[model samples]
Target: WVINIVRFYKVYCDVEPKRQALSKANADLAVAQDKLVNIKAKIAHLNENLVKLTAKFETATSDKLKCQQAAEATASTISLANRLVGGLVSENVRWAEAVRDFKQQKSALCGDVLLITAFVSYLGYFTKKYRQDL
Candidate 1:
């Protein structure tokens, strides 16, 4: 009976360690399963955000292309306007100089006409001897 008791005690000691190891393995497996569930949920959320961002990026790229085209057209128009205005400015300066010359010539012509008219009228009325005496 004592030998039988010793044998039973030895078997109990070995079985106890195996049971504890199995319990620990089961707990670790449960924790790992929970973490896996959380990771899958996070991946799903990230994929949705990526889809939305991709759509927004495509819209922004199209808008950028349109804006660049508009800018180029505006720049060309501004260049044309500058060239036209430059030519007109030079023409305006030349026109102003011509007008000033015309004004001066008109004033000189008026004085010349008055002098000729006076000489003709006085010379015709007086004789050669009276003109020489005066």
Candidate 2:
């Protein structure tokens, strides 16, 4: 009975440490499960934000494309206006040069007529003087 009691006590001591180790492992498992739950919640929240950000990014891209199209249209309109203005300026310059050339020709013709008339008058006076002297 004495030997049996000592063996029993030794067995009990070994079982106690096993039980404590099991309990510690169980506690660690519970803490790990809690951490996993929190991490899952964070992942869910991050997924929701990612969805929202994707939608916002699409909207921004659409708006940017529309703005670029509008800018291109404006640039085309300005280019057309510039071309028209250039054509009009060129036409006006041509008209001004033509008018200047016409005025110069008219002045030259007038000068030629005046010289012819003076020469005719002098010729008539000299012919009358020659006839009277003869």
Candidate 3:
């Protein structure tokens, strides 16, 4: 009985239209499977690219942070240098004033010395005349 059923099914499936339809369906399934495999490979490649891009982004972020820190340090150094320059200018101004004061004092001292020398000369001449008279 099973043999008879198998023969009937085989004959029905062996018709030209049925055989062509089955063959076309099998080909379509094979193409679909191949497309699935290619899609999966593309997905894997895209995942690897994502990982690489993530690493590059992280490195770029770290480098940017370092640059910011360097900029801050440079700013502080510039501020300190400016302060030092201001201090030097102040000291130079004080030194200049002191020099002017010293010159003024020296001139006054020279005038006083000239006056004392003239008075001593006059006294010396008057005593010499008195001794001659005696």
Number of the top-ranking candidate, with TM-score as the measure: 2
Off by over 4 Å in 2: 1-7, 92-134
Candidate 1 runs further than 4 Å off: 1-9, 88-134
- Candidate 2 — which pairs collide? none
Worst window of 10 by summed lDDT in candidate 1: 125-134
How big is the positional error of residue 57 in model 1, measured in Å on the Cα after superposition? 2.2
lDDT of 3 by residue, 36-80 (tens): 999999999999999999999999999999999999999999999
Question: Lowest-scoring 10 consecutive residues by lDDT in candidate 2?
Answer: 125-134
lDDT of 2 by residue, 4-109 (tens): 9999999989999999999999999999999999999999999999999999999999999999999999999999999999999989999999999999889798
TM-score for each prediction? 0.54, 0.60, 0.55
Better of 1 and 2 by TM-score: 2
Q: Candidate 2 or 3, higher lDDT?
A: 2
Question: Each candidate's lDDT (Cα)?
Answer: 0.93, 0.93, 0.91
